[model samples]
Target: MSLDDRQLLRYSRHILLDEVGIEGQERLCASHALILGAGGLGSPAALYLASAGVGRITLIDDDTVDLTNLQRQIAHTEARVGQRKVESARAAMLQINPEIRIDTLAQRADATRLRELVATADVALDCSDNFATRHALNRACVAHGVPLVSGAALRFAGQVSVFDTRPDAQGERGPCYACLFPEEAPAEEVNCATMGVLAPLVGLVGSLQAVEALKILSQAGNTLRGRLLLIDALDAEFQTVTLQRNPACPVCGHLTAA
Candidate 1:
């Protein structure tokens, strides 16, 4: 696909990079991504993905914009309160880049829907705030052989990781989300509602998730395939923990036959 004059100017910066030249930018423009939430993480991620000219983006969120979401959910404004999250986010995305296709699913991301979405998407972003949702996304991605970028931010802490089902040149398998935290390792749910999150904290992590998503889609930079990036906003510290695929993971393991 040849870049038009407008696309050339719009993606000039990306085309200027050696890693992401015209070809890579085209690859990115031909890719599709599904974001599983329209909250803080999804807000910035969808914004960047749209601005970057990703071919298509599907946003799944059952929630409506709330007054409290203005703190970090930049996509939703005070006037948009009470509107469906997907509708609010789609409007913001179109304002950024109307060239791309934006699909809005204003419903909860259940297992069946997740599987269908994952199958069609080139990459999946787990921007949901709950563990159950995260687990469901991971399982769907693994089943469909799609890469997943999982990110979370609450209070002063944030984390990001990429789970690629495809192995690297070394022939070693990439770790899935369950590799970082085993299924049986207790479950806890936290969000900006109960524990406040800094405004820029979510933007930082969410934007980074967008970065990882693009890299994975274009096969350009080194993704966080086996490394979990941890960020401490309060003290401004960053850490990386190595992860591995768990052979005993109930969701990803033994299900290759199913």
Candidate 2:
């Protein structure tokens, strides 16, 4: 979809970039993003994607806003405390850019639901807090050959990465999320609820998720396909670690076999 005069002005700063001129912005405007979870990470990620004019965004989350969520979940307000997270997030996103389409799913998705959602998305963002959901989303992305942007935050530490093993990509294909964190391995389910987190930590990770997602949607810049970005907000330290695909990954190993 071509950007109208109003849209061009709304996204003028993005259009000014040589790498993201009218063509790139158009690509973003025509892309669809799937965001899993509508809490802290999904909040900033969803809002940025909305403001950037990602044509459609499907947000899936089965939780409702609680008074405890106001600390970091910026998409919800005090008045919307009892509202479903996806619905609250949808309202916040529409307030940013009403021209785009926002789809809300207020349910905990199983494997079948994840497959259906990933099939239609141009890119998928893993903002869910649990390992179960993350693994499910990663598997779906691998099956559909869709790029996956994953992020997480706990305490003052955060990490983000892109896992895309699509056959047509140049150079060696990168690891899927499951390649680095094997699904068979026991994962300690940690979350902000049990282990408290810094407010801005999630924001930083979520924003990076948006940056990576936009890059994939626009074909601009190198994604963190084979690298993991770790942030230590308390000490203001940043680290990038290379990730290797596990040939025996239970979720994505079949891709190599095929």
- Which is the leading candidate under TM-score? 2
* lDDT score of residue 27 within candidate 1: 88
TM-score for each predicted model, relative to the true structure: 0.96, 0.97
> Candidate 1: misplaced stretches above 4 Å?
255-258
Overall lDDT per candidate, in order of appearance: 0.90, 0.93
Model 1 clashing-pair count: 0
- Shift in Å, residue 186, candidate 2: 1.2
Tens digits of lDDT, candidate 1, 5-116: 9999999999999998999899889999999999999999999999998999999999999898998899999999999999999999999999999999999888888999
> What's the residue-level lDDT of 242 in candidate 1?
88
Q: Candidate 1, TM-score vs. the true structure?
A: 0.96
lDDT of 2: 0.93
Q: For model 1, how big is the CA root-mean-square deviation? A: 1.9
Q: After superposition, how far is residue 103 of candidate 2 from its true place, in Å?
A: 0.5
lDDT of 2 by residue, 1-258 (tens): 788999999999999999899999999999999999999999999999999999999999999999999999888999999999999999999999999999999999999999999999999999999998898999899999999999999999999999998754444567899888887789888888989999988988999999999999988988998899999999999999999888777777767532
* Model 1 poorest ten-residue lDDT run: 249-258
